[model samples]
Target: MSQGKRTSQGKRTSRGIRTSQGIRGGLLRRHRDFRLLWCGETAGKFGASVSGVAMPLVAVSTLHASTFEVGLLSAAAWAPWLIIGLPVGAWVDRLRRRPIMLTAAAVSLVLFAGVPVAARFDRLSIELLLAVALLTGTAAVFFQTAYSAYLPSILEPADQPEGNAKLHGSASAAQIAGLGSGGLIAQMAGAVNGMFAHASTFLVSLLCLAGIRHREPRAAMTGPRSSSLVGEVREGLRLIAHDRWLRTLTLFGAASNLALMGYQSIQVVFLVRTVGLAPGPVGALIAATGAGGVAGAFAARRVAVRIGTARATLLFELGLSVFALLIPLTVGGAGVLLFVVGGFCVSAGVVAGNIIKASFQQRYCPPELLGRLTASTAFLSYGTIPLGALLGGALGTALGIRTAMAITTAGIPLAALILFFSPIRRCRDLPTSRRPTPDSTRPPAPDGEPALPRP
Candidate 1:
């Protein structure tokens, strides 16, 4: 072959390689709609994190709320998942998700801003705080349900893991920033003023959402509408109950959340009253611990690829949770490192596990049923959060704060037992597709009983 001809072929190959690499650049850079969505979601997460610290601080410092009341405050934020989760899912399936998300964001902005307004009027009572939390939480429920279903429409099946990882990673980073900022803002001006920061983020999110170019196609109505809301909800529940993989993950998630929320509900009180930390330090410490989530998010895709998703789930969710016991051992000065380390592990584990779960659901479930699937599973998993918060508050009241922390932390690792006893333990990778059940099959292994056979 002629040397010039060989060189020309090499140049063609090199140009092809360059084009491929350019296409493979970060999802945020390559996809405009997804980037907008990511920005909106991350901004919203930052706001929530700020309020997570500020709201409780307001209750403790300004309103002089008791320990149980603080726990109830936390519970109020998650209680909507129990009350309206099912109906919300069915509704999301039927509607254009972006509008629902926009409305929810608008509602949240008003609600958070109302806090400082009420404070200015000398009407900032614990009762009012609870109402704000409750209302914001309700908005969150709608936003989240719609958001989950809408995501698949924007990204291809292959790109989902990267998308989930980027979203989760940025969210973790935003949480760290927000938590730290919440403390400083509280110390400098006051906790009440921090709500302004929280409210402002939603405005950013709203603008980002508005900037997105892609519009989801309206959900197609097929045939005569035979299913009532209740019937649709039951279909979602039945899907989870019948699918062993879904059932295992959902059960484990519920158990894990219970334990997680249990300790988290009283962490502010423990740090303030027991660990002898100021409000600023409390937020900073929590922010520091959240760095683990950032690590988890960055590592999730690689870890899953290296170890398989199912095994990665166990390692992330179960193995890493063992460090949670260290949080209860925290004290003044250098002993605070114990809490940091423990919280880091727990955060990393949860985030990584979530990435795996999110990718799985987007890939495994039918697009039409994704909304219901997300809602039903979340209803069970997140529903336990309020119960856990109340339990933590009750335990802290009955036992010492330290004792309550220890008890709750123990449950974190123990909750993984739900995974161990189910089908997840026997497989390496979680199945990418669920097997179809015949239309005539009996309603799956009634609720709690395992349904699908081992992969």
Candidate 2:
């Protein structure tokens, strides 16, 4: 045989061996790096979940914060996304993702751990709690932005969907466990101890992340060496603005989040005040919503395959989320079940939609632009969170909690119509590529179901 033919055959055999290995073992069992990353993320989510419950409890129970103050605390945590999201994207793209994650995790650990110490010293207050929440939240913005762009680098294009599913499933599972346990911890060990538990999870996450072996591709040097940060940030914004699909999804995400947060900001208040539930059961009920998320994560791929990705998105977003209106119908005894059911469907749809959307963006965006793309989208999507929190708080204080909830919950279905009326509804699959600019030489994005002509 010729030398060239022999070399080609060897390469093919090596490729076949790797493919066979992947098939024989699932991602958790086979891919060492992925397993580590998954574990770290799961641990981080667990910590965040504990803190989510603990923080509000501290505000309401210990400090006797009013409804608007509670909502303000929630808003403080997310407000950084709108304030600094754009610049962080450019920064993330310029640096490695893992180190950013590690740094963020460490910062969170110290901040949360300090909460208990401050409580012991009789120095804890609502303002201090809000500060910690805001700083930790700021760290999360960078961590999440980097993490979104990092995943595609670790997993191949073919494994991306499964990777996303597993990550989402584990995150939901972690949240369930955290919420379920957080209430008990607060009851038995005190809420300060719950914050300590939250601190510990970030430690585990830090250790797990420290073990990952994959190094990101070095930032590309082909562009002008002295590019301005503003220019880089603008590029991300422009790409989203010009791309119809990204624009549509961004708008839909913003609207959906706004509605979701509006109700959520006041949900604990409504449940505690109106439904007359104790803290422990309240956590359990909230945790129940995550059960649907676990289901949604597992079902995302199958649903997309059956209905087509674009249609499935609308189905999940519009069809399932309409159930959100049932939450306000909830009463004490058997009626709280209505809240659980409605929350379940909404949680399921949101998780499934996120899995599909994350995978799609990974496959569709240019590798270099992923960080900025994620940040820009998140900036809009999460930016409304503070506004919603304030709106919900105001409405709750003005019109009563039940009335505020009803109005906000109804907005969930209304937000989904943005997608239905856009190009997403008519197309069976989301387009993989935007129309190429005349001066650009980048390849067409990964082709999913063949492109429909531009709308």
Candidate 3:
């Protein structure tokens, strides 16, 4: 694949620009913009990892929140996906992604910084924490929706897999490092100070984004003028509902996320109360799970190439998710290994699956519909997160954390059945190109998968 000349918005305007003219021949070796993007994401992800630990610690330690309230905190953070996701997708298609990203980062930076300020004034409460989580989550919804559609314009199709691998790998590494450091920060300076650390990462990300020189195409600026928001959103929904592959993946993602978040919602409380772990140790253990994600990121391409992407996906989704059942069996000695092993497998599997699927979608879907496609799918997938959190909290409050964890963790493997019964199960590799079918309800192709639907 060839590199292109950049516009002012960090997007490539023409495909004729050459990277091999000087010492820039190697892939991503000389891609200045991509390198900056990678750095920014790594920094941002690190901050998120720290906040992941600090947020719960503050709830459990300082506020003395109930197990159900912790779960509610988790729910509040993700509720925006259900509420504003569809409209945001429509808006993202109409606006330049970089500006949206910048605005989201700035907002998140301010909001997170406010937590510590509130704490110092003796004014922090569960309501304030929940509100901060909800607002930050809303910003994330916009930023993430925009970023998914933005990546394709910055790199050639052939370079995307490698780019994704690098970005995912670095992000996992950041998470691992951040988790350990975050725990230490919580133990030393208190959880409120960790918010200050989280706030700093956003500043780093914003600066990196500001340094990018390419400009996006004018099409993004004016293309949606002819269409209404409802019309555009409907088109996105239609694409997901009609396409068999997308339909299957979206369903599987939703179910899987439901189970994943269910367990994650109460994992900290379980480890602290049931497993008898301290805050610092809890952070270290969570970081250990992220080590698996790092491995998964680096291993994703190799596994896909060796076994075929389709088969590898099942192994990751089904085979690895089974280990999640071990989590609730932990006793406090060498038995802690059960929780570590189970969480690691699940984390690895999910991250690897995401890498493969993201690359597939980028290759298979039309560029114009990418934003809507991402939003529509996430609307269902991440939409389940709040529900899962609520379910987990309710179950924990009623049946006890261990039993609730067991029931939820078991659902992870069960979620894979959606894919196992779909066309994805019979294939070795997912389709790379879209084929026009005479009708949406037509039979599967000779290859065993249905034709890709068009927007």
Q: lDDT values of the candidates?
A: 0.86, 0.83, 0.84
Expressed as tens digits, the lDDT of each residue in 218-322 for candidate 2 is 663224432799998898898788777788899999999999999998888898888888888888888898788888898887787666678889988888999
Residue-level lDDT tens digits of model 3 in 1-455? 11245232222212211122311224457788888888888999999999999998999999999999999999999999999999898888877888899999999999999999999999999999999999999999999998888887787665676777778888889999999888889999998899999999999999989998877865673333436899888988998888788898999999999998899999889989989988898889889888888888978877876677788889888889899999889879898889889989998898899998998787777677788888999999999999999999999999999999999999999999998988777766776646556564333332344443342
Candidate 2: the clashing residue pairs are: none
For each candidate in turn, the TM-score is: 0.91, 0.92, 0.91
Candidate order (lDDT)? 1, 3, 2
Candidate 2 Cα outliers beyond 4 Å, as residue runs: 1-25, 217-226, 434-436, 439-455
Model 2 collision count: 0
In angstroms, give how far residue 188 of model 3 lies from its true place: 1.1
Clashes of 1: 0
* Clashes by residue pair, model 3: 7-214, 7-215, 8-214, 8-215, 9-214, 9-215, 10-214, 10-215
Overall local distance difference test of candidate 2: 0.83
Per-residue alpha-carbon lDDT of candidate 1 for residues 112-188, written as tens digits (9 for 90 to 100): 99999999999889999999999999999999998898887777665677888999999999999999999989889
